[model samples]
Target: MIEYRIDRRSGVATYVQIVQQTKQALRMGLLEPGDKLPAAREVVEATAVNPNTVLKAYRELEREGLVEARRGLGTFVRRSLGAAPADSPLRGELAEWAARARAAGLERDDVAALFAAVLDEHFDSTAKEQENR
Candidate 1:
């Protein structure tokens, strides 16, 4: 079961957090197709969020073709997203790299900026290559 966590201080809307976490779980293979998402009531109980908030998140996911809500049963995952699984070697290597960065005194935001820069550089270059081809 997926547990929703609401960080009130994170500046992100509660519904968005739920949507993003659900997508993350899908990408990580933690939630596979046919998996039942937690009932809105359960998420509300766990996170102290409004039932409507949970519903809104599920609705957003459904809109994205990632999940569907049944009449009585909970929402079911429609498909998985992304190629990277939670246990992938690439994830392990990234974790080790993050640990090394932490040990070298990089703060969370600093590491995030560096990661974003690298992603932009690589993905932008990849896009250019595809355009050339």
Candidate 2:
């Protein structure tokens, strides 16, 4: 089961936010194959979003082959994405690093930008190396 959080101030669309959060859960091992997604009505009630919005997000996930809708039941995860588990050591190290950054007075946006730069530096170089090989 997952809880939906709606950020009205965020420029991202509500449905897209749902889809992104669901995929994030799947990647983090919080949700797995056979896990039943909360009913559209449930999400609607929790987030005050339109039922169609939730359905649209679910449909997009289905289109991506990430989930399937079972009539009379609900949507269920069809497969997972990524290799990182919720309790992975890599996550622990990152959490510790984040704590240190916070203690060092880095704002959330500052940390995010720094992390994104590091990711771009490392992952982009790795991708280029693979392409060159």
Please give each candidate's TM-score: 0.82, 0.83
Across 17-117, the per-residue lDDT of candidate 2 in tens digits comes to 89889989998999999999999999998888999999999998999899999999989999998888899999999999999999999999999999989
Count of clashes in candidate 2: 0
Q: What is the model-wide C-alpha lDDT for candidate 1?
A: 0.89
TM-score of candidate 1 on Cα atoms, chains taken together:
0.82
lDDT of each residue in 1-133, candidate 1, tens digit only = 8887899999778888898899889989999999999998888888888899999989989998999999888799999999889999999999999999999999999999999899997776543453353
- Extract clashing residue pairs from model 2: none
Error of 1 at 16 (Å): 0.7
Clashes of each: 0, 0
